[model samples]
Target: MTLLLDSEEGARAWIGEAFAPTARQWQQLDRFGAMLVAENARQNLISASTIPTLWVRHIADSAQLLSFDRDNEGLWIDLGSGPGLPGLVVAILCDRPMLLVESRKRRCDFLRAVVAEFDLRHVEVAEAPLERIETRPASTISARAFAPLDKLIGLSTRFSNESTRWLLPKGRNAVKELALLPEAWQRMFHVEQSRTDAESWILVGVGQIGAKQRGK
Candidate 1:
């Protein structure tokens, strides 16, 4: 594979040796700016303003979700996969079947292009709203900057079984969101410092709808 090196020599070197097998993916992520910018110009996906911080805001932010679990089997779903954050990146790094669900046709087209451009075999794009799709229980479900915690959990309920694990990257409101979960839904999380910010965290846990509401 042609090594598409990053402009920052140190980052390029680290990505090459550490992410050796995924070097091509690293290259594609490195070129994210150009692709996003090009797509944004035509009113396709993300806005051009986010391009400046694409590495930290998009790539690294998504990559950190991989630290959540070691299990690679079973389906992994990313909801509201706009511009493919933690979903696409996790799919590339982890050995799991990845499904990216998005309602918009334009974003889905962009996601497909990214998958094709990187020749990513483990990833698939589904063009449908989360509520409308028929999916089996996913071992892992993730979302980033998509919706508030309560709403996300409610929507995720459609695809989660007792065994499903959730990996959500949240900002300052993580703690607040955790507080809102019903008391019966046991949860544990740690505040890991993020690469882009001092207070961000990647939260992971398995939870079931409280027994009182389980039958609903």
Candidate 2:
């Protein structure tokens, strides 16, 4: 695979020195990447074609979530964590408890392996669909390239509370999706251009949600 970003100790050092200023958890992040690639060869978790772009596409993409709440505490959950994006990265960079929700057995195994390899004390992997897992109201919930905005909100309704913040890494269709949101939702969010892709965007929202409803 073409190496878009460094995958060695140097890369870890670079990420630690550059992005994760408060923490030096790059070693764990690197191990997480390796675990993803190794398991991906057996079954599809992330697109195999994106292997070459792991650094910018996966690592940097996930790391950017940190910019949202640098001092975030409480629990953070990553829904549909195919290859553990912002969840694993967040666990390494921040001190909060983190959970990765994935239904596929193979992917869950891979996540567990990475967590073990890196000795990530605060990160846990739940090998069940998002609907079945029980989580307290999260301080932050991140969904990376998981589902459409409306659908994601529907699916993650259970985990959202008055204090929950949503961090969604979306693509070119973000604005269009935002326009389509129901007016009754009564929330405020900002759209920022992605650092890795010009056509992509990151959606950040914080506010109280309406009463909880059954998710799809």
Candidate 3:
């Protein structure tokens, strides 16, 4: 796959062919995008300037995560899922059972409303911080613009086992963030170029946290 999607048209085209959403899924996404814009008027769900490029910037950016998750996995968990960028987007496009963890009340309300609106029975909204939520083995855990690499791992390690896959979109900070990790963790994750932006990058990894020794 090409590393970077240079234009809005390219990103949109890539997402359509890459995921190939059903008619119903496309409807859900279209509705969700409209709802997101309406909700943004009420509160700061997303930046106003990006509204024009919503399809490529938000929807397609979120959809690109699916390319990394070929197996569909078990339970997909999204931490600090404010506005459900990839979480709701993923649930809308796929049948994977998902949990969206967000601590803010208003955001949680919005997320629940979307869930109800779409009747997404497989998706659950956890209105709490990651530390407060109960632990369950996560087949895939994703966080976008969440905490720093070390802090995120510190908070979420309990939910991961050896087979767990961590997909973190760190944007331009991907390489710098990965470098800050302990040597063991640095070995676990490798950065991948993002399809949505040439300057952006994603940190992808698989393994139980702390399993690898610092020097080994």
Candidate 4:
């Protein structure tokens, strides 16, 4: 894997090269980053140590998921979206309809505040866990540090159909987590090196996942 985007400037340049956000989108992202920093002091939104590299570690890390789902077909469900990682980031950058599922009330409030602040009409917040949320098909499903691969698949399989795409940022454990899945599920997903970290990885999968076969 290549070196990570270590500096803010490098992250900006990479984002520009990849997505080329409009002026308005850039403004939204900037404000969102500020909000995230401010909120982090009150709640554990993200690691305090990563504050210096917020752009590269969090913002860009989340933004990178968009590349995997360029078609933007239908609803994008972000499970356990504590601080909206890619879900809110994706909403700010584009008009993809999104549902951010976060179980905690405080985080849900924060997410709703961001949606209202930005007037992100395309996004919705489900203030509940994955199991309690109503079942509906999703075009793309994303999870970051939500759960291990087997448990994550079992919990999320209900929302996916044949065409749903899974974009999970499992960090450095991406390969190990994918390896632990049953053989069929192992075939359903593959790992992609993260642009922001050489050792980190993102799990990408297309097609629906089955729940029954997921076990130890």
Candidate 5:
């Protein structure tokens, strides 16, 4: 579903939440957007179709992720964090440490540029496949447009713990994917509607997801 851009500016108005960014935060978001726009022309950081609705589709979609963390402490891992999205967005929004995992060298460069530009001390970019990369224990994890639910579980298993929660943005197919997951994982996860897009849903998983592959 294509997101129709509103003239109101910023995603806070559209998200229907009490999200408020200081002037500095908005400026930082603007710089990040500028960097994406500039680099996207050279490397396709984001889809060409999303340029107009970038704020609502990307920034807002990413920003709302922080609301899921009850502790909001420890590290937050963003797997396959293409162009930063929620990982950088969450890092800029709060003071918690964020680990952004990306495989491509170019994307990692772009993320590092943003971190340097913004002086984001809380953000770290890991440039490798999730399986090969050594992952720190994370309090929560997020992935956007990365992989299917089952495959995501397979990749993220190493980073998760007894308390680690998973936040995945499943646009319109949340129900179908939930149905496809193994029965053991059924009890551990639930879906929540996205505040930005009504058609989108955020899948939140608690505890361990796979039973058969336990301790693997």
Candidate 6:
């Protein structure tokens, strides 16, 4: 795969024909996007300026996280899932069970409302911060613009095991931020250029007992 692409067309090209959403999925996404815009009027969720780029910047950017999960069966835990970017988007698009964890009460309320509005049975939202959350092991974990690589490990280690698949999207400074990681984590991560922006990257990792045991 090319990893990085030129535009939304390039992103669609990269995802290919099979990734097209069903009519129902598209409806849910549309509803969610409209809801986000309406809710933004109530409080700060996403920046108002970015609303014009909502489809590509927020929706497509979030939806692409699932491409890394080939099997598409297993729990997906989205850490600090504010406004449910990939978490809610993924839940809307896929059948896999998912967990969306957000600390803020209003965001959590919005997430729950979205879940109810869509009647999505496979998605669950946790209103606690990652530190306080005691949840089951997840086979896949994702975070977007939430925290740096090192600190994210500290926050999400419990949700992972040797088989967990991580799909963390780090914009622009991915390599630089990745370089700051401890030596042990260097072995486990592979960087993929983002479809939305060439400067961005998605960091993919498979959890290993060795990395965990070594205190990574």
Q: What is the TM-score of each candidate against the true structure?
A: 0.81, 0.84, 0.94, 0.95, 0.90, 0.90
lDDT of 4 at 45: 94
Q: Stretches of candidate 1 above 4 Å error?
A: 1-21, 44-49, 186-191, 210-216
Model 6: how large is the Cα RMSD against the reference? 2.3
**Model 6: what TM-score?**
0.90
- Expressed as tens digits, the lDDT of each residue in 90-193 for candidate 6 is 89878889899898999999999999989999998888878888858899999996898878876787778888998999888788887987777766789987
Ranking by lDDT: 4, 3, 6, 5, 2, 1
Pick by lDDT: which candidate is best? Answer: 4
lDDT of each: 0.70, 0.75, 0.88, 0.89, 0.81, 0.82
Per-residue C-alpha lDDT of model 3 across residues 1-216, encoded as one tens digit per residue: 655665677766787888888888889998999999999999899999999889878988888887898785699999999999899998888888999999999999999999999999999999988889999999999998689888898888889888998999999989998987788888879888887788889899998775445334
Summing lDDT over every window of 10 consecutive residues in candidate 2, give the lowest-scoring window.
1-10
Clash statistics: count for each candidate: 0, 0, 0, 0, 0, 0
Better structure of 1 and 3 per TM-score: 3
Off by over 4 Å in 2: 1-14, 17-24, 212-216
Which residue pairs collide in model 5, if any? none
The Cα error of candidate 3 at residue 136, in Å, is 0.3
Error of 1 at 194 (Å): 2.5
Error of 3 at 30 (Å): 0.6
Query: Tens digit of lDDT per residue, candidate 4, span 1-216?
Result: 454788999998888888899998899999999999999889999999999999999899998999888986799999999999989998887787899999999999999999999899999999987899999999999998788888888889989988999999998888988887778898888888998988899899998765555542
Best by TM-score: 4
Structure candidate 2, residue pairs in collision? none
Candidate that beats the other on lDDT, 2 or 5, i.e. the better one: 5
lDDT per residue for candidate 2 within 92-180, as digits (tens), equals 77778998998888778877877787778898899887778875788888999678888788778678776778888878888888877
Ranking by TM-score: 4, 3, 6, 5, 2, 1
Residue range 6-83, candidate 1, lDDT tens digits: 334433444344446455566666666567778788765655655665665566566656655665478989989887
Looking at model 5, residue 191 earns an lDDT score of 85
